[model samples]
Target: MPAASASSARSNSALSGSRCHDRLRTFHERLQSGWRMSAPLELFSYWRSSAAYRVRIGLNIKALAYVTHPVHLVRDGGEQHAAAYAQLNPQQLVPTLRHGAVVVPQSLAILEYLEEAFPDSARLLPAAPFERARVRALAQAIACDVHPLNNLRVMQLLEREWQRDAAQRLHWTQHWMQQGFAALELQLANALHTASFCHGDTPGLADCVLIPQLYNARRFEVDLAPYPTLQRIEQACLALPAFDAARPEMQIDAVV
Candidate 1:
């Protein structure tokens, strides 16, 4: 093929990609408008679960109204294990989102869903591909590497299955939390992406994930002084009403 022909084809490909993005954005705008005209969304959540806390931030950031159906993870042998809630989420996890007939499970997936389903909401992802990837990598570094190993089930296993005492269990949690935060601190301490929040001036996915983990860190009595970058970011996030309102202590069913 001629060089001129190849150039023309490339131009056409770029145009096609731009058009597709515009159409998708238009669809999302319509969805957001429709949601505003409807009732509040329903979320199955446990106030103390970090994953659930993350979802609450996303919902508030989107400016989407939602009513929480408290799924006590501990009371009455864990309400999430009941037959009714299991039908919505077979995994028996907190933070399951219900919008109309569409049910979404998984915290990260639900965040992405809100972004796509309600583009008018606060932008959870940057328009640039590389920036979005970076933000996701930062968020996953905590959500996957840190939070999972330190969750309630893990603590329960340490007590019931392993017979580890409270002091030993606290040590176990502090170990993994420190390991994860040390690497994250290095990543954010001086990077260009570091700002008031996780990505840029606006709070997005990384902020959503990080704030919850910080809450967890304090809960386990992990010494946070070592990670100034994380602590600074958490302070910035908590200053915002959307994030402050989503905190575990602010929930209707928060335990004493």
Candidate 2:
């Protein structure tokens, strides 16, 4: 077996193990805890959205129980605009987490809320404040810089309003991804703070955002040969169960 194949197999196995454990945890919470009514969490999501994917990773990392409600983004002129979906999320974004009455919007805000609400869970940010800031910086580098410009809605706008052809769209995606990856490569290469994962031995916010952006980059056929450090970190992150489970391809609503 080739190395990549072996690696992919191991990742799939780990993902299966994580999901099995999640189900068991969920079962114990419901059956053993005597909750007959409602689940603790409700995650409004679209499977392919990377923003939602980030929140999913955070949920998995904390081992929190949350049921996903898929919202189709492209069907019927975008279901996100429907009155029902709009009521849940005024911003019309996919990842709207309902923790009791509190509706959390934005992936980063959701992650922060999870960290605060469940402080006992594995720390997503480091102990030191500066270290935590560094992690946030790395995460935002991809989330803000790379993803927004290449989002489906944005691409559609470029096509309709700006009259961009398919070739132009590809150029735009590659252009932004290359810029983000190039800067990220330099940051990761020089910073000794980076380790097996984005921050240290364990995966953090940076790893979560990085993996999704890399997925998009590949989808756009962006040459990753220029960003070896980013690739190495992605490989390291995906080897772990939390990151593997959050992969776009593994989502329940994934096309393939």
Candidate 3:
């Protein structure tokens, strides 16, 4: 090859590399400035969904600005079953968070991500390892053990497959909630860490998880008289603007 031709090829390659570096530097600068690359945070949510409600609380507590893309869970046989949303979250779940090019699914995972990504903002988990674990355990007691059993899919399955009536379904929800809340009431009522909120005076991850379940309990007319501790905590959490603003009724997509 001619020397000039080789020299021109090398120059073009160097130019391309330099452009890539510049683009990366710009992206980093935007992130550092708290500005997203192409867009701010976007949440694919269903207003009445407990999982989505949890994410909304976390985002509000952090005071992060985000846009909501409402995915109706019950309309037209559920919008989450669509191909577009499925690409974002193969689980076809609500509360799928999108930040720039990154996509995150699952409410707890999204909460943890927010805590890590925006460390300077309000914290969702405690600094101590043991405290974090304790909080997570409490959060999971509701999120994992209790909520899943009463999820929309579970109710649909019970109705479609097992021919469970509305009264039976109500019993199903109330029974699991009672069992879980009984254990949580004991744990929170006796734990030294319990204060105004689940872990301490300020609401954290567990509070976020707990409040949504409590909302469901009320919706199903679960006997709250048995769990005084939970009722107290729910009151404390609801008094806060973050928790209040994140309620299912406050959401734009909420149906009357």
Candidate 4:
């Protein structure tokens, strides 16, 4: 190789390394400064969506500022099905989170990401491994085992494909919620770890997941008298400013 070419190659490599170093430094500075990025976080949400509701609570608890891009689920046969939004989230689900170049779908994943990305901020998981697993089990019980059965898409499918009426839909939602809440009530009522919230005194992942499902249960007129423990925790959570502010009615896109 020519002497001049080798020198040019060395200079280019040095410049690339310097650029990478600068990028990392900037990112570190942003993380240390409470994630106050120039781009800001963006959330694709539907106001009444339980999944979106959970993410809102997590964001509020973390005290993170974010921009809400409302995706109306009903109007014009569901705006989430539109090409542009579909490209952002192939699942066409509400509560897709965009953080700069990183786009995260699913509410639980978003909550976990926030906990990891901003460790200096409020934590959504406990420090103990066993406690963390307990919290996650409770969260998944609602988010995975229960909420999916009663979400809008499932209701739509029942109506459109199975020709189920509103009364039938209500029964469907109520049955699943009752089963889930019954189990949750038993766990919380017996567990020594349960405190003011699901896992401890502070509201964490389980609380964030639980409150939204309770809201849905109320919306569908499910009987809550059986789950006194859940109701008590719900009251404790709603009294907090973070959970209060994240209510579906308080959202900017809420309908009357």
Clashes of each: 0, 0, 0, 0
lDDT by residue for model 2 (138-226), tens:
99988888899899999999999999999999999899999999999999985889888889988888887888788888889999998
* lDDT tens digits by residue: candidate 1, 1-256: 8999999999999999999999999999778678644845788999899999999999899898889999999988899999999999999988899987789999999999888877767899999999999999999999999999999888999999989999999999999999999999999998998898888899999999999999999989999999999999998889999999998989999986
In model 1, the Cα lDDT at residue 72 comes to 96
The residue pairs found clashing in candidate 3 are: none
How far residue 244's Cα lies from its native spot in candidate 1, in Å, is 1.1
RMSD of each candidate?
A: 6.0, 17.2, 6.7, 5.7
Q: Tell me which of candidates 2 and 3 scores higher on TM-score.
A: 3
Q: Which stretches of candidate 1 lie over 4 Å from their true place?
A: 1-39
Ranking by TM-score: 4, 3, 1, 2
lDDT of 3 by residue, 100-200 (tens): 87899999999998898788889999999999999999999999999999999999999999999999999999999999999999999968999999999
Lowest lDDT sum, 10 consecutive residues, model 1, at 32-41
For model 3, the stretches where C-alpha displacement exceeds 4 angstroms are 1-39
TM-score of each: 0.86, 0.84, 0.87, 0.87
Off by over 4 Å in 2: 1-39
Report how far off residue 20 is in candidate 3 (Å). 20
Q: What is the lDDT for 100 in model 2? A: 72
State residue 50's C-alpha deviation in candidate 2, in Å: 0.8
